[model samples]
Target: MLKSWRRRCRRKTGGMPELTIPSHFLCPISLHLMKDPVTLSTGTTYDRHSIETWIEAGNRTCPVTSQVLRDLEPIPNHAIRKNIQEWCVENGSRGIERIPTPRIPITSTEVSEMLVRVSEASDESRCREFVAKIKQSAKESDRNKRCFVANGSTKVLSAAFAAFSNADETVTVLAEILSAMITLTPVLDEETSSNLSSEHPLQKLVWFLRFGSLSARRNAVLALRSILSFDQFKFEIVVKIEGMVEALIRLINEPICPTTTKASLLSIYYLLKPTENSKGIAITLTEMGLVEKLLEMAVDSDRSVCEKALGVLDRMCSHGEVRERARGNALMIPLLVKKVLRVSGMATEFSVSILLKIVRGDEGEEERAAAAVEALQAGAFQKLLLVLQIGSDEVSKEKVTELLKVMNGYRNRIECVDSLDFKHLRRPF
Candidate 1:
């Protein structure tokens, strides 16, 4: 009967050879096909426990290739862990299955070695494959995947940044991250403004803000800044505003960190610009007593920071209430006027352009017109005319025409001691 059972089993297995032992009983860890499998100091094969220890120590590299083992989180050793647990549970009432386990086609050690070699590889095409794998792993929800990205090692960030440095690649990555934020925004909790993680997406955003390249920084700022324009993300928006304000305050206080300071100020400008949903931001700024702080920054010694702060104020000035508040403060106007006069000719032109918006309409027409006329009468027009006169031929004649138009608007109010030739003003000279 046993011979008949064996014959029947062989018949069921078809042309396959008879199994001496069932494959499932074998240890998957030792069975994994590692080209150069890690061997411990004890000369035993490197097992899951050893790998986990190395990973916990933040050594995520293979011994051979020094390639990053992105999948560093612990996994249950199916052979040992399950067997021990079953033995404890059943007290060996059921013997372990005699199945022989098929080896995993690749092991963590092999993958790490391969990745390290790929990282140092000179072949652009292969490097691209490595980058794709890293990004792919980042998108997964597996604990291992999360640990890999959250590792925050310079190698991973550098690799990610370098991969997307090309304009098209950068745009693609930005679009993906933006889309993910939008899709995930709705599902986020309203009260806490946190994402699935305890640290909100904005915290991740701050990471990018601090470490990303110039273009990447710009893109990140633009994305987070856009969220302030939507009411649905109000809580998230507040988080960003807080982050921005903190960064701004730091930048304002720390003169040593100029690049970060300038970047942060520029980011704040983009974040706090006037928009329908950003009315809350204005209120928040006011509540935080940021108006004085912003005004001080507008006159900062650093031209870039000062110019950016001026831009933020200019945008804020679009709101009548904000404008009135700034104007009533008494300090902003003189500072703005000084900026208009103190900058180089082109910068002066930009400052004047911004000032025009403040003084544009009939609502506060007289006050605004008086300010412009004061600036003009203070020889601003003459300085501008001089720029038009002596600067390169590249000067926009239309800008010259615009200046003449501005001067002409007040021509009737001011008496001309000397007859000025409009025809000469019309000429390029």
Candidate 2:
């Protein structure tokens, strides 16, 4: 009956192209053209009503696209109503067809080349416009949509990363790629994450963190920082972070990545802050004995990594079990001392502030204070005195004074090093 109707429609339309949908597009319960097109609240059309009904039953899908629709509102259209009725009569009771999955085509090299050229072009405004056009094309063109999912466009993304070696340029490229990836990841298949081309954007992001120019590293970190909010991409993010952490640790040991770059990578770790779901990942890293690896970063020659490592440590220290694990591994004290001494002036200030908080007893007063005193005695007080003496400005002197007050107040069995001859300590001012 549905075939006869389709034939009639064709005949009436003067032999238009046959409406030959793959079995996958056919409704399972009704062996016919999809009816009511499961209009999601957002106006997408899908063939399956139960799926649409299930979505409508909850907050799930668009009526037309079956894209996980959210925030739906009613759309009134007479044509839609007519289409629904015509569809129900012809195929509503028919069984669904058993069709194989559709194969989306890969992006052609032409598209990839165009993307590369746009990414590398000197005109910022033009590049942005090109990116906008590509995104719009992806939304409107079936071919582009399929290509985005199936091919992942590694060559294009690599070209973008390669083009933007400078910080500003890198940031612009990163922003564009991030926006595109965020928009597409949800609609993509889980298998798409593994696609080498699709994974290129993230791979390049990691490379920037590892080996790119300083500005590129900073931009990459900033871009990656935004990806954490994409829930659909969480698994891929976790994988990327693990790989990044390992690479950063290795790089720190090699003395290749500049201090700023190392610092940027360390900052990126904060973006991966462990959530309830990410607790297992944290535990896995801890169990793998990465505490020592992380501690080593705190003393890195790069001031940026040193500061970032302290920030990372402060976060990890907030977790009692992780803190205990770090302390038990003898990885905490030396790092704390380095924070007080080896880091830049601003970093030293920040480190002292963090130490003050750590000693404020979130981990039970007795143990944490004891650790604090041990850290203080292990050269923080002496280093503070040196900073006070050699300090060239008021801010440094003020920071030293503040640190002294904290140390004096905590005078538990730790010996007080003599105050920097206040005379000399004051000379810098």
Candidate 3:
């Protein structure tokens, strides 16, 4: 009957028949055909994507009814879906295609239940299995991630990590749990921060940095960065942990991967970033030989790594001891000069800040003059001029002017320029 009706309609129009779709088949939100129809608590049906997007935008009221969604869960309108599919099959020649069955979304209840299983597992193997399952579900789609976040997976995983005693199997399970928790960091609440900052979980994260798999190490650094960002007071306690700074420095010194290397650099920056409460962190990091590692990273061709390395170096160079250490490295002055105006604005700012610190050292006038001479030989004099000409932030501009004055005072006093300075002078002409 549908075919004969289509034939008659086509014969009248002399082309494909125009089938009028039922109003009920359209989503109330999108006003398009409901491929995967789901009924909201307000008894209005919308396409799954439409409603999910609506709710994700923080809307609690249904679009059609404007009624409060007491239960945010959307029930699948299976009968309407089946009808839509049948209609498409019947109108196959009318440029309509059947909708495929939608995958059942993981619910918050399921996520909560999974977390419960993860917390209640009896042994390492079972715990590992449940944690892996959670990781898999979280990786499946964005909806599942929202479900995990809504279900408080971050707190549960952090608690699980703290519960484990030190063992190879336990470390393995803890690493997996940490990896899973890393995905749930869309927002870090106070409770989650408290849980992660506690002794056991913090130690486990540090352990992962030193001994976990490559992915685990990367996840650990990212997790630490988030925790530190969420709570700044933890810095004082975190730096005191044994081997915490060393492990991060190792990752920087012997990079596992670009991601892990950058993450470690960022984590270190969070620690050594100049805060009134964090005054000693820079000293501690430099004493652990972080200055040499940062100098090595500053020269990396990857501008991101170079920028972060310079940012940390700038922060550390605020200290007289760190400045002395940096100036001691033959490559440090030249690296800072090369980065100015060459990498990025942030990079140039950090590079200029470090150079300014170098030339303005607190040791003595003799030490400052010697550092100024080194800057001149490193081609910093010309780069400072370019920064002024090319236009930079007011702070960098001022620092560039000061750096040029200091280097100029020493430039006339020095007789020899390094090959780098000679090269720079010839290239621009």
Give the range where candidate 1 is weakest over 10 consecutive residues by summed lDDT. 188-197
Please provide TM-scores, in order, for all candidate models, with all chains considered together: 0.41, 0.40, 0.72
lDDT of 3 by residue, 89-157 (tens): 987766577888887889877888899998898687888899898888878778888888888888887
lDDT of 2 by residue, 119-206 (tens): 5667666666666656666765454655554555433543454454344435565556544544443322333333312355566667
Cα displacement (angstroms), candidate 1, residue 53, comes to 42
User: What overall lDDT goes with each candidate model?
Assistant: 0.48, 0.54, 0.80
Candidate 1 C-alpha lDDT tens digits along 46-115: 4443454565677767543566665544333344534434433442222223323323333345446545
lDDT at residue 105 of model 3 (Cα atoms): 84
Please list the residue runs of candidate 3 whose C-alpha ends up more than 4 Å from where it truly belongs after superposition. 1-35, 41-44, 58-72, 84-99, 116-130, 165-169, 186-190, 230-237, 240-242, 273-296, 300-303, 319-322, 328-330, 364-367, 373-429
Give the number of the best model, judged by TM-score. Answer: 3
Candidate 1 matches the true fold with a TM-score of: 0.41
**TM-score, predicted candidate 3 vs. hidden true structure:** 0.72
Determine the backbone clash count of candidate 3.
Answer: 0
**Pairs that collide, model 3:** none
Segments in model 1 whose C-alpha atoms lie over 4 Å from true places: 1-155, 158-199, 204-247, 253-256, 286-295, 298-300, 329-331, 344-346, 390-407, 411-429
